[model samples]
Target: MDQQIIMKIDDLRMYFNTNGGVFGNKRKIVHAVDDVSLSIMEGETIGIVGESGCGKTTFGRAILRLYKPTGGSIEFMGQNITDMPERKLRQLRSKMVYVFQDPYESLDPRKTVGSTVGEPLIINHLVRNKKEYEKRIAELFEIVNLDPSMANRYPHEFSGGQRQRVAIARSLASDPKLIVFDEAVSALDVSLQARIVNLLADIKERLKITYIFISHDLSVVKHISDRIAVFYLGRVVELSEADELYKNPLHPYTKALLTAVPIPDPFLEDKRDVIFMDGEIPSPINPPKGCPFHPRCPFATDICRTDAPQLVDMGHQHLVACYASQEGRLPK
Candidate 1:
């Protein structure tokens, strides 16, 4: 596997001032993403797993320049892209595509599948003429296991899973090198989700595409990711190899998340430590002072609530942000 870095984000922060400064009191701001940084390696899938409103989607959008980042720099293949001009960014969009969460909502209901998939080719001028364009759309349909005959039909004609396949085909239309999977399978049924996940796995193996797969579903992330980054309220609490994360989560928040996954074997389920967090995720406008997880962490200490923990290396590419992880005091 190549160790080259494809995307590098340094001290990334995306905040929103919900109230005016000083008078209305600069009281609280929504820290959508706060002082977060991570690197994405070429040809590897980096799974970002977190609960809803944890800023996983914001992080992805920030890197793609979908939102002008409040702070920090985003480097794409070594080119600084945090503040690139619109024209250059438009050109770069081809190399980095985004697959939206809801296939039902993402597709334009007005457009035919043929027209929807072909839109990229037309915009990028990848194909020469109308005939060649139609042929290319047909090819993409075959690539995603969709019947070519259905190309003429609108999005409403397709099943949820089939619509997602069309969505995948649309993303592949530009032959992207780095694709963002934003909750790509969350909207589908269980069987359909499995099919899409398997499809992505096969496509990655064949095309060597690097991905930033964001999801709350740890099972899917574990199945598809080479590495996993667990986020909480805009900050990453842990990052490690996929298998390692499931089998040996370091951060308290990570362990809590793992405990939430249902075990199939009744015997094994009985032996696993079950963690039930007490509160809903605190508001982004006024997140806790210390470790974001400290508010709900059963093992939190006085220091954990007063001072924030920095992401520290815990050997072999595993990193965590809890005091326990830093001091090697974590539970077995």
Candidate 2:
């Protein structure tokens, strides 16, 4: 199969202006996402992982145009949509949808599960009559492994897992080509999370849908993602195949994140050295001068503090943005 690039994000940035300092005299800029670029391949799941405020969610919203980017271009299916009109963007909504973290909040409490799932179909004019709408809703329920008979029940009637299934069903209602799962399973129990992750993988295989799975849990993202991007303070520090990244992380932040994931073997777990970051994550309003991670990086040098490094491709398209990694000083 010929590889296809479904979405391309170039130099994407999202910033929010707010009152400056305690006096609130001047305006300050919150750098949510800064100069990040990546391409999503058709039928592949790309995971974005970082701490709570590392801009993973903002990056996803920017790609979907939910948050209009502050700078740079976004190309979806070869069409530049960064500056596209809202009227035109609405037409593309049917082809792309977002599955939020909390299903309870996303699904309507007042509406029946069937109605909730069918809303997108109605909005996109996917069905002609009431019968067609109900039929499509039933099929969608079954697609996500939910019983069609439960369509009439309210969202409160279902379990957490089931509600997420409904949310997935609703997203699938539009027959979207790309679905952004923004911390989609972080709210569910571990077992439920596994079930949803497997369902997402199965759906991708069956429907050939591309996904942008965002989560702070490295383990969760590792299970569902083909490639993973590690974010640090609104910037992508490293990006590579999931397996390769876990086994051989080049960036200091990436290595630290992997070490934090508990190992199954007691011996390996005890033997592994965990890297602890010293200070808290810098404020986005006034980040550090050079590399964002320089303050906490163990190998930070004068160059690292004075000059930021761009994401450099090492080999096999594995990229990292760190002076140590580029200088071959990273531990083997």
Candidate 3:
């Protein structure tokens, strides 16, 4: 059976205006998320990976209507929500939620963990009485592998990992259908990250929830994602199944990112050649003409400097946006 598409985004563009001139009089537009389109299926975990400032987080927020997109359409659950009014959008908040990067800052220092977890339930009117609320809070805490007894404590009392678990608990309080996790485990240690990733996988199986996981760490994303999208300068450069992307990356930027991931086997790691990219990422406010990655791509051609390449399928559902890949100029 074909899986239902939970969310569909078309030509999603999110631009930000900021003062740029010396006198602060001129307004410059920053292309945070430019002409990106994707479809997320129900019960699937789609990972968005890229360098810092590549619009991974912005894309997630834009789809969730946390930031009103400058252009494009966002359809969630067969409803067009791209320009939905705040009042109407509020009603959908219970079904779609965001789990921020910093658990420390996301939680209130003054509020107890139990209250924090119950905030969504209270706002969505999920529970009727105090007893029902407490029972739901306990269930949420237990789902995240957190002790219900610790719910009475403050956010500052818990460790970074524990705090993140608390945040997860809060996000699940209303039984959301789709959750966007922006760098959810980036702040924790390696061990904690693995544990949290495992917990999320377990929860997804038990609850049948859909997730959009955004992060710059490809290694971490590989473990949790079913399909991965590689972003560069606010656009998707490559997208494919997680294992397929690692096995055969057609885009230069994707190849470079994979090379940077350290292999566990010392002998194989030493034998592999690393592709080092030249130059820094271009500023979003004044991005270069033509292809966004042409300036740093080693295989860039004349056409690459004059015309931007759109993402095209290269068989087996692997999509790439490189002129060299399309023209068969890149070495196999």
Highest-TM-score candidate: 3
How many clashes (backbone N, Cα, C below 3 Å) per candidate?
Answer: 0, 0, 0
Q: What TM-score against the true fold does each predicted structure earn?
A: 0.96, 0.97, 0.98
Cα lDDT computed for each candidate against the true fold: 0.91, 0.92, 0.94
Once fitted onto the true fold, the runs of candidate 1 whose alpha carbons sit more than 4 angstroms away are: 19-28
Q: Which ten-residue region of model 2 has the weakest summed lDDT?
A: 19-28
**Which candidate wins on lDDT?**
3
* Per-residue C-alpha lDDT of model 2 across residues 148-210, encoded as one tens digit per residue: 999989999998899999999999999999999999999999999999999999999999999
Higher-TM-score candidate among 1 and 3? Answer: 3
TM-score, predicted candidate 2 vs. hidden true structure: 0.97
**lDDT (tens digit, per residue) of candidate 1 on 1-332:** 99999999999999977757765665567999999899999999999999999999999988999999999999997899999988889988888889999999999999998899999898888999989998999989988899999999999999989999999999999888899999999999899899899999999998899999999998999999999999999998898999888888889888889998888999999998877788999989889998888889888888899999998888878899999679877677
Q: Please identify which of the two predictions, 1 or 2, would achieve the higher lDDT against the true structure.
A: 2
For model 3, name the residue pairs that clash.
none
